[model samples]
Target chain A: MPERGLLIVLSGPSGVGKGTVRKAIFESPDNDFEYSVSMTTRQKRPGEVEGVDYYYRTREEFEALIAEGKMLEYAEYVGNYYGTPLDYVNQTLDEGKDVFLEIEVQGAKKVKEQVPDGVFIFLTPPDLTELKSRIVGRGTDQLDVIEKRMEIAKKEIEMMTLYDYAVVNDSVPLAVEKIKQIIKSEHLRVDRVIDSYLKMLKEL
Target chain B: MPERGLLIVLSGPSGVGKGTVRKAIFESPDNDFEYSVSMTTRQKRPGEVEGVDYYYRTREEFEALIAEGKMLEYAEYVGNYYGTPLDYVNQTLDEGKDVFLEIEVQGAKKVKEQVPDGVFIFLTPPDLTELKSRIVGRGTDQLDVIEKRMEIAKKEIEMMTLYDYAVVNDSVPLAVEKIKQIIKSEHLRVDRVIDSYLKMLKEL
Candidate 1:
């Protein structure tokens, strides 16, 4: 039997470096990961390529897809609609290529409801202190915004229980290596082995 | 909160390189695996160390341990009693070290009943052809014995579903590496994370 691809849903609290770790893994020749392009009604940022950065769409088109039940999950943030399209994910899985859904806690939960077999992973900081330091080091938000973000992060960390695995993003290279190992070992799980080999043995 | 160790139960069909891969992993400095010694009535081999290899015991003592429910799993083979002692395993786990139980299918099932949290792994050859070649290469068993072993191997492969992970023994180094990843990832599973942090996080 041909091998099936894995749907890896990666979620984390704010400032856990999910983007950095994911970039390192995908850039390295060792991993073959496809980024799932989300459909968004928000204006495309400068230099963000269509279908690469996101599958940009109008609000009406996005709402149509949602009503058609093609969206795995969707939300309106600051009046912009963002959603995960189900067709592309299913197609990629059928082609035996892994697709990563790098989302927040709420989005991850929604995806899990639709695709329960996907590998749900939560990225974490080394500790709360380090997480605070990382968030401060970014130097992007004011004190009030930072405090609000910290509160959200705490709540999200509590929701780590909703994930299957928790990866600590202490360092980009190390975190990428650990996640790579997880993907490799998950392929060798018993359920897959049984699905791939069970009935064939009887014929042989 | 203190971290807990894992009970790793490794099982495979006869002559499937279970011993070879296990030896390679234990010999490596990369892993900190503790070998669980079995209480056995069989005579120890020439080079086999007493506590390191097997805890040699009289039948009376072994039966007494079994009656006391001290045996995690016990089996009789060729008029010799061999069983895993629960005290030793629990002690090793308390020390926060991974313990390997290299037993066969029947003993593995028994042990699973007692230690339901153990990570049960089934090791396999690349295929039956490779398995047959490996057994024939050893040149130890008669033709009838080899045939019987092959039949048993087939039956054991059918029971691969009983395991959590299935490591194909394509190469000793590769198999060892896969198992290492499994151990590392299992440590990061959400259930363990919850067990280690659920109560402590509330205090913060």
Candidate 2:
């Protein structure tokens, strides 16, 4: 059987541009990994293509998958169920193709509990101040709400300790470049590739 | 003090083209790391420049440095002492510049003992047959010598388990690319870059 592929997770504090960077990586022509399209029970937005943006599922269908233990990680947001499908991820990985997941910090933590070996990357802002400005720039929140978000963002930044990498999203291309390098290097990591050499040595 | 730079070591079995890959890397204008030129007690060879090729030293001077614990790792071969100078490596790394070392397996092991956190990369031949062919292609060894060299190569290949990455020397360019990725990713590892984020969080 071909070697299993990496489960690469990109996640971090809110407004860290994790989605932008993940989109940039996928938009790149040389991307070889499969994007793990999420499943959600929410209504589809305008121009959102099925299986492209998300796999829109009925509430019953989503809950059934969750009950069957087929959701890699799932979370309810405003009564909408959103999650990665365990079956899709495992099938793609089993086929020797990497599965990319751009998730929230809490969802990433759940993924970590289930797949400890996944390459968990934390895309951080240049600093806390930059993160605050990004959140403030959203302009939809009141001052108190922004402060509350800054507090939550501070807590999420602390979760960087749980990740395998902390990439500063100073620029989309630069962050994408670093993430690509991380994936390439992870494939060459000894723990992941040494078994073949060990077997080769035994044969020799 | 600035963050300490990574100690990147490239090593592998004999005739695995470690020197070729290293030369390719250094020749690239984008290469950022400093190559740790070795110091040796051997007589200067024809057309070999001191410091660029090696830091030529007398036996007495080499011994003096060794006695003073100035060598990062050293070995004796053909009545000559060859070793990496400890001061230069530490000084470069202290200045927040990476130091790259391309050495043999034994010297790599010694460097590992001293710098366990260093990024150690083992370059392996595609397979035993390819390794044997490469050794035989040297055209200087008798059958018995070739056999003995193969045995030694086998043992060195087994030492790959000690490394952080194993790069197959299938093609020099491919191997160089992988090494470049490894270095880039190594710089992003959480353990290496997390301190700054932790400090940022504390201030926040």
Candidate 3:
């Protein structure tokens, strides 16, 4: 049997540097994993590509996939449908490629329900004070939005208990290394390895 | 608040290099975590220290701890009691140190029940043929004992589904690196870091 691939879910509060860590993991030469490019109904920006950035789709097509249960998990944000395509993820794993899904807490929960054995990783900032500073440093949002995001971040923090593991994204390289380790370690699970051996022994 | 340490449980079939991987983790300069030395009624062999290798205890003492529910889990092996001491693990975590327990599948399961949030990692061999070779290559066991161990190993493999993560010990150094990464990543759990910040904001 072909070696099975792992479904790794990455979630963290805003300003935890998950995006930077994901980029690092992708850039690593040692990693051969595939990042799941999600499909969305939102219009692509000037620099975005259809498949690379996202599988940009019409609202009708997005809703149809959801209706057919083809989407692993989807959410409507500002009237745009954003979701993971189940077929693409399954196809990647079938090819013995690990799949990485960077998602929010709600989407992660949904993915877990559908794929019970998927690895769920929660990323966090080094500490609260540092997180607040990072958020303030971004200078993107209005003061009111930053305050709201922080409030929502609190609720998300409580959900960490639900994750399979938590990785602190204190440094980008360190966080990426941790993600690689988790994936490598997960490949050693006996459930997938020992069965073949037992069968071989019986044949012997 | 002091960062909380994770309760990590590592288990796998024999010959999967779980011990070697753990040794690598301990040897690494980045890992300051404490390994939980088990308490046992088994007689200490040559070169084994009481507190360092294991908490060597009398049968009566072992029974006393088990009766008081102080032992996290225990089992009788070769007429000797083998189990984990609860206080040391808790004390280590309370001091902001991660605790690692090298246990068998049964003991790992029991620890998981008691510590629901404990990280359960199962070490696996690269393949069945490699596993068989490793078991036979050990050269310490008699043919019969090796056969029985192999049989038991098969049974243990079936329990892999109970574990939270599977790490294959293909190479000792690589396996250890993966484990270290898992530990580092877990520290960044969003709930802990984000909640700390939210609490700080509330105080303000």
Q: Pick the candidate with the highest DockQ.
A: 2
Question: What is the iRMSD in Å for candidate 1?
Answer: 4.2
* Candidate 3: pairs in clash: A166-B185, A166-B186, A167-B185, A167-B188, A168-B188, A185-B167, A188-B167, A188-B168
Please give the DockQ score of every candidate, comma-separated: 0.44, 0.48, 0.30
Least accurate 10 contiguous residues by lDDT in model 1 chain B: B195-204
Error of 1 at B119 (Å): 0.9
Candidate 1 docks with a DockQ of 0.44
Q: Itemize residue pairs with steric clashes in candidate 2.
A: none
The alpha-carbon deviation from the true structure for residue B58 of candidate 3, after best TM-score superposition, in angstroms, is 5.0
lDDT of 2 by residue, B64-175 (tens): 9989999999999999999999999999999999999999889999999999999999998776435645557778778898778667766765697899998988889899
Q: Give the alpha carbon lDDT tens digit for every residue of B89-141 in model 3.
A: 88888887889999887898899899987778878767644656656767777
- Which is the leading candidate under TM-score? 1
Judged by whole-model lDDT over C-alpha atoms, candidate 3 comes out at: 0.78
Candidate 1: list runs displaced more than 4 Å: A129-154, A202-204, B128-154, B202-204
Model 2 alpha-carbon miss at residue A182, Å: 1.3
- The DockQ score of candidate 2 comes to 0.48
Tens-place lDDT digits, model 3, residues A1-204? 566688999987766777778878888898788999989999899999989989999999988899899999989889899999999999988887889999877899899899987888888667644556645657677988777757665665566767867776667887787777667656655555555656755643
Q: What is the C-alpha RMSD of each candidate to the true structure, in Å?
A: 5.3, 4.7, 5.9
DockQ winner, 1 or 3: 1
State how far residue B100 of model 2 sits from its true place (Å): 0.8
